[model samples]
Target: METGAVDEASIDSLTDFYLGCGVDGMTILGIMGEANKLTGEEARAVASRILKRVDGRVPVVVGVSSPGLDNLSSLARFAMDEGAAGVMVAPTPGPAVEDRVRGYFHQVCEALGPDVPICLQDYPQTTGVPISVETILTLTRDCPQIVMLKHEDAPGLRKVSAVRNRSGTSETPRLSILCGNGGLYLPQELARGADGAMTGFAYPEMLVEVVATHQAGDVERAEDVFDAYLPILRYEQQPGYGLAVRKAVLKHRGAIACAATRAPGPRLDATDEAELMRLIARTEDKVKELSHGS
Candidate 1:
């Protein structure tokens, strides 16, 4: 959930909802989670609060990406002390070539030390710094701390295939690849070779089910389930505005106290809310139809 002046009761409510949905883990302070909009104290308080509530029920991963490695390491250390399973870092946006990117992360890994497992977030769309497949592979090869990849490159199916193929053929330590385009291409990502999804769709149960269903070897059934939620997924993929849509849906579902984001974040006007509700209604009916084997 987006951090704000929301009280403890609301935090507990949101945590309960996500727990009920059976998410393998929770990622706090992510891009969708509005990490940038939060004050440092607020971010730490939010992380510590969620960690306490979750209480080892599931692993909690924190996003510690920052402009300076010291800030990243500080946040990472605090999260680790707070019992985070890992911390995620994406390459900072700027004019960066592959070697420069690699060098930056190399410094990041060194600063974080080997004790902290890292999730290399590869969302080029947001960062505006594209990480080539080779760079990712090289990082995995060299950085023993990198334990997972949050792959969110659009038109990224081939990248998934390339990474997986390289993993199979090479001697590098294997990294778990989780796609993050709001689960839009979930079916195809799984087909191409994603281990699972780390994207935020309001209904995380959908992502959990899609991954489970696809991995069960029933691709057709998986696609059916995916197609049902595709509309809302697409609607929620609107760049800067999507977080509001997600928060609104969660609020509508009674999982949060307010759909309002921090100031400077997008607000859903009546028209936007109506359109979102309409898509949500259609998604519900479609999900029900699939469940009934129609």
Candidate 2:
């Protein structure tokens, strides 16, 4: 069955969450764990479900961060077959990082054919490695299907410079560079040249508003929104409390079923929970004031 960008069933729940909250795109983290560890067939099944649920109402991008080249290719192919708008591939660390990563992408591009767009997941902190700007340029030049770059580097200006520099090159193609720093330096990054952000915070509306306002050329308005949400962003960055805070805010706003995270992650303490609630209350007041005035 043919699927539209936003109408896929597997991601309908998330898509509904984002659309209702006013986000332009939806990014899903592929959990490769015991229960959810998906084979190629299983991945396709899940992707199919997501496509059906979303019903093409929004663009769905899946994370294809498997450990091996084969796994990455399979997942990318599965997502493409199931109608994902794009696939985000994380860099694999090794002596041959560039070669392996580039080769994996080449294989996936071949398997999925030329039309499937891929996003380079440049998450240096989590991946323990990084893809240089030269590498990005080479990949984009060689594979036209690789369209976006999800940059999660700290001091994100580096990534922005890389993209801008690449764009300045002769015969360079336009590629979307999305900030993935979870709102910490979003405004600055956007000002630098980021197209958008792909974060995991509960308040997608805040992000959507910030990015849209910035893109619309209202720098002052975007800064105001960023400043208003600064408190929540700061609180979420507290050590040993980030994800807990995210889940708390999500639950407070009635966005998710629970603040439950996979094991090995810490649970929020009373103090952390109280802080999260306070941040949410303050943000709510500011948002309400903005809405009334607007």
- Please report, as a residue range, the 10-residue window in candidate 1 with the lowest summed lDDT: 1-10
Q: lDDT (0-100) at residue 166 of candidate 2? A: 72
For every model in order, what is the number of clashing pairs? 0, 21
Off-target runs (Cα >4 Å) in candidate 1 are 1-6, 168-170
Candidate 1 structure quality by residue, lDDT tens digits, 96-132: 6998999999999999999999999998888999999
Over all chains combined, what TM-score does candidate 2 have? 0.84
Where is model 2 more than 4 Å wrong at Cα? 1-14, 30-46, 96-104, 238-240, 292-294
Residue pairs whose backbone atoms clash in candidate 1: none
Q: Give each prediction's root-mean-square deviation over alpha carbons.
A: 1.8, 5.3
